[model samples]
Target: MATSISFVGLSCFLLSLCLVCSLKEGYAFEELIESYAESYLTHTFEVSSLFASSICNHSTKANERESTFRVVDKYGPCFQPSLHRSVVPPSLTDIIRSDRARIYSIQARLSKNSGRRDLIVEPNSLGIPIIDGSAFDTLSYLVKVGLGTPKKDLSLILDTGSRLTWTQCEPCRSCYKQSEPLYDRDDSNSYVTIPRNDPVCEYVRRPVDPPRPINLCSYEISYGDGSVSVGFFSKETLTMSAAEKINSFLFGCGTDNKGPFNLVAGILGLNQEDASIVFQTAQKYNKIFSYCLPSSTSSTGHLTFGSQTPAPAGIKYTKLVAEKSPFYGLDLIGIGLGGTKLNIPESIFTTPGTIIDSGAVFSYLPPVAYMTFRDKFRVAMSAYPLIPGPTAAIETCYDFSKSTSVTVPEISFFFKDGTIVGIPGKYSFIEYNTTLTCLGFQDGGDKHSIIGNKVQRTMEVVYDVPGQRVGFAPNGCS
Candidate 1:
């Protein structure tokens, strides 16, 4: 269940007390923008550029110069309102394609092989994928899910970008709606609100309004990408796979903001900005988070929590880079294709900043690598008849009839500490004959490659923000 999108809580403090700042003046605008960006990507580390584009290009709030500290305190997130808009998104065709190389990697990690979740991928009554029916083009990895008073039941997106625990709410101003209304807490027995005396609130930055006892209140949170997630706080009893109840767990009931998504019940923020229940609860028991992404071609992958699993010895372990902590677009780094060394030139690495985005359907690359491969593909397609765009040049299914291989070059990244982050040969290439169009970032190279959920599913990747490190090893996910 979710609260209204319009019902986002702000710490009455920053909004009312602080003087106004403007984006035009440069510094103040840059400060919040930078802070929010870190806040945006802080949770899951998986982000879509569409959010950045929306925030910078389409926002009316971008130019404002001054405001009352009360405004910030009251509003909480100043830029969030303008961010609720349309978000250009990536195609699932590419999403499925990203998984090709990962299958091999997973076999080496978990040791045990398995299938996917029971959730089927078939088209809904509307002829689109069931998951895509929610209609949001933008994805933010919940920046944070909040624990609030007036607890309620909620459904949320388990995301990589945001780390706040939140939920949809009751007793809020205005709100958003979907084909259906927000979640009805009345129907669920699982909601609770952590009281003021609870130790959990100590970790939370309180709202400006002191009386707000970490109540279940959906507040507005905006991402640098110009997308928003509206949710409220509540206490919940989370059950592990084995039915072990993790009591007094605070979480959010996510409500949909704008962008590709029409409206959603709630989102689960896994990023670092605010730290979600997943993080909070994980730490409560001295646990860690890990994931096993599966290729769309095959239906399998697992997102693990606690001490469920760990990477094998000898696999690469790179501490997450924390200095630039805010750009939390997945736990991504540079990869070397075809055995390219870590010290290779920057040109091949694409850029120092890469997005380890789990929500993204595909592993997106900048113009050079994409077009270089596209041209080669085009030359080869000449042998067969091809179509483009609206119509598929070839079927969107894998061409199992023939053997094909895509050998992407290998790459590595240099940490600020002068160490190296490496992605082995298994991650560099992928081949599929069936689908012709999945994802294309255009000739304009994006700042970095979006190492999507597809690649993440292949390994047991641990995102340790406090330690500033990301560890990965092959798994049996695929």
Candidate 2:
């Protein structure tokens, strides 16, 4: 059995590492951190405390700054900013630039080190035309916004650039038909638009390049990623369900120079802590929204507008760590695998970072941790030495079939509040091969490593942006 260790704490989180662990009470520590989840819309709090109170309070609850954000009580809580703050590292400007050069160098190495997997690979997403720098499905399933009576059932991207939520007018835009069309505001009969240039608009606005010279109450936005989104500011009704709905949102409808995105029309921002269509609507009717992501590489995912996506009943849920920013992250003080805090050796803990990012497809375990875990895992699995590997299951492949469920180790996360969330079961095995005989999987990368989505899917990631915290457990969120 493994016990918890302490690290650092919040506010004073700038010390190389951002957190520490400190257990409270003498309550048997719950044997394991109890898994649970709670979601409240911004209206749940006051708008005046968007980044301050709502976000701060949430951060205080979960104890990290990775997931909370403040939204004006006057508007709503939609984006978590803590995840998008001023933590500069050699400048992303530089990292983005160096990617192309680095890719050419790592291609051969990556190909030569492939492995095996137990999961099935998706096929529909293969060979899709992606803009440079677009990794994975970053460019998939675009959704366009619209106000009034517009289009319906169209595929669109939920962009962070534009503020308006308008789709193509009747008869559609002369450009290309988006992969998905805009929702007809009039048809659902629940759409409502906010005023032009409201406080919410100012916060969500992403300025566009080659600014369009026009206005019927509008704005423009450009992205650091080189893409652009533009539209007139206005309120729109959202007919989520027969009983749930909201009539307020910022959106645009006009000529976008960023010529039709193939299979994409606009962007549906599922962002909002208290306000956005989903949260606001949820607040008004006491409901929750859910989206589903398919693990298949060949099929498409579904991002539904209303109702919580049905989840496996036994999968435990965890409350997300809220923070004061525009992004979401894990609420982790630290992670100790196999109940061993010092298993990784001081050399790795002192290193810069080991983060959990949903945007990133894999988990990055340090070499020290990987090796330590790999060896112990092997010893535990001494029963099945020549077992089959789960090709895409782990960043590193392994097949020692010691009954994945049987050899489940006590993997734990150190939280700022002295609480540890111990994850049960080895989400995957550690393998040592790159041959086809190894299995159907991705080859591990050189710099440290990534655990990827496969493992991430096993944990319920509570990304409370305004609070700057990330809560992790053995299940995914609703």
Choose the strongest candidate by TM-score.
1
Question: For candidate 2, lDDT tens digit of each residue in 194-294?
Answer: 44445664533434332233333444533323344455445665433333334555455434424323334454544433334434445442323332222
| Error at 276, model 2, angstroms | 4.6
In model 2, which regions exceed 4 Å deviation? 1-151, 154-177, 182-197, 206-213, 217-225, 252-266, 270-324, 338-342, 345-358, 365-395, 398-411, 422-453, 458-478
What TM-score, computed on C-alpha atoms, does each candidate reach? 0.51, 0.47
Candidate 1 segments exceeding 4 Å error: 1-155, 167-183, 187-190, 194-218, 223-231, 254-264, 285-287, 307-310, 327-335, 341-344, 347-352, 364-449
| Cα error of candidate 1 at position 239, Å | 2.2
lDDT of 1 by residue, 262-322 (tens): 3334555555543464466555534355554432221223445554332444455564645
